[model samples]
Target: SKLICGSYGTLAVIDEVTIKTLPRPETSLSLLFESDDMASAVALIAGIFASPHEPGAAAILPQPVAAAAGIDLAADFVVVIRLEGIALSVDDRAGHLRGMGGTGGTVETVPQALSETLWRRIRDVDLLADHAGDIWKLSCPPASAPQIIAAIEPHFDMAFYADWAGGLLWLAGPSGADFGTALRAALTLHGGGHAQLMCDRGKSKQLIPALQPLPPAQAGLSKRVKAAFDPLGVLNFGRMHDGI
Candidate 1:
């Protein structure tokens, strides 16, 4: 290749397969918030973010996740929420969520077999390893991801694979997704860090600009000089969503 520039989640996921067993592993717990209306559920969890003394992982689906798995969505919405840590912590959180709505949805520990499947889906990047597309990494407080997911998930038709334990999300949407708007909304609700998008397609270029921590005056001077060099604005304007 003539050039290469991008962020790769895992250059490699596994060298070989191996397994180990624990004599007595700690228990893992999870909850399913079933609702015909997902919008309401989204608000409930968003409320939790307001006070995150102990938040494990929360994901709200505007539509059923079955569509992502190739099955048509049958319900209006379904939210999959998980809380894990020490056994006592997880148990307390689970009890809280259950008390939110009348108990109907199933509550079960993520089975060992299912855990391996989710891990492989997230850890393995072989399928997308070769594509040339800009990869955007959005960073927000861990608790805010669910609300952010809820806000944008309803608008776009795309694929999303989330790694909540690591507070990582990978979303592939249409070419012109409103990343700036989405980021702002998420930041407002959850309150956290900035985001980075690495261009992986169309000549392996860098799309969004790298963030800096310099004083505002120096940053402004640098921006002015760059604009002076290309006063006609010939470069891909606003690709970084910053108005020059």
Candidate 2:
């Protein structure tokens, strides 16, 4: 089950599946911290995670991405932290989070309806819907994100935002750039992470891999697992990787 879950249907075919859904929180609130730079915005997110407020979701949206999502904040970057649960608990946490006071930015409380709408757009990557290029999803240690972004910025014409308190980055780069290579290089230089090409609208799709290459030991293990599941190598062959 563990091996088949994220295998992109390269393993066994499932006949049926069941998923358990949780009850939605009774109420939610979001705190928005407007910062002038990525570093400061990320730092504010870090501070929120360190506190006992326990945010349900946290993300950093740069000015362009925010504007694209219809967030009309007059700031360079916005750090959004959401708290959810019973009405009283959510309100309490939001109050504490607001008192924490971000560095070099004004903080605003977003109403519940607007908060839901904003996070939905972020989760769906709707802000980049019109981007006519390659989109990449990256995950690394939260603290290393600023450096990774800095490393990649000079090379590509791109737009990006961070979620999971800056641990996950969603980036859209020009169609023809060697974005996969450049992004992996930046990840290696800063800290090891995973990169996956989510959308491709140009020739680079044939030139670059959609997923990062696995390390030697991990690659061997994956090959062995694949053989166990599909001995004839016929099930979704090469869907995830070149040979296996």
Candidate 3:
């Protein structure tokens, strides 16, 4: 929790980090499950996280995105669950997950190389990096995710995927979408949460704020902390918000 990650150098410039390299698990397996039921798909994933077979990594990608990632599953949604540990333990946990569906769902093993490729896509978290559109990353509770997505769907047509077991949603929409109003309102309704505009390719660079506007109180505290580190405000100044 003390470590800073995923922030694009706006927090602190890490010259080096002494990280503990975990011993490689003797057996690592990636499991892929496909189904039309988004609710059940997410529920199964939730169950996995709450179970003894806690997954090392997990994600949910829609059919189109799954196809893009070369994951072939004959269903509308694909839940990717990865298990890694002792060989026998991994297999036993996987069997438990498979048995969760009985004859109702399709559970399959994903090849190692292919699994790596798909996870990389999820990690990059830039579904529309090249497009002249507004890209947003949202973080909220997993249970409230489907409702949030449901609300955002009618307002702006966007493609999305979930990571961290649906706690984070990477969504993209056309440029000039109402993030300040409609989109932000939807987020507030579900649960007051964080939403950052990753990029706005179509907007003028001079006008667009580097990140979405933070609440006034948080904005002030952010500036104070940044000043403690970079008093001159030299490192990526204005990249997060004005005057910081």
Per-prediction TM-score, please? 0.47, 0.95, 0.84
For model 2, what is the error of residue 169's alpha carbon versus the real structure, in angstroms, after optimal superposition? 0.6
188: Cα error in model 2, Å: 0.6
After aligning candidate 3 to the native by TM-score, how far in Å is the CA of 161 from where it should be? Answer: 0.7
Point out where model 1 deviates above 4 Å: 1-25, 35-39, 46-55, 61-73, 85-96, 102-109, 119-134, 141-157, 161-169, 175-193, 203-207, 210-244
Writing each residue's lDDT as its tens digit, candidate 3 over 74-120 gives: 78888899887887888888888776653377788875666667677
Models ranked on lDDT: 2, 3, 1
What TM value does model 3 have? Answer: 0.84
Q: Give the clash count for each candidate.
A: 2, 0, 0
Residue 203, candidate 3: how far off, in angstroms?
A: 2.1
Kindly give the stretch of ten consecutive residues in candidate 2 with the minimal lDDT sum: 98-107
lDDT of 2 by residue, 132-214 (tens): 77889999988889899999888878899999899999999987547788899999998789999898878676887788989
TM-score preference between candidates 1 and 3, better one: 3
By summed lDDT, the worst window of 10 consecutive residues in model 1 runs over 1-10
lDDT score for residue 75 of model 3:
87
lDDT per model, in order?
Answer: 0.48, 0.86, 0.73
Evaluate model 1: give its lDDT.
0.48
- Per-residue error (Å), model 1, residue 86: 6.1
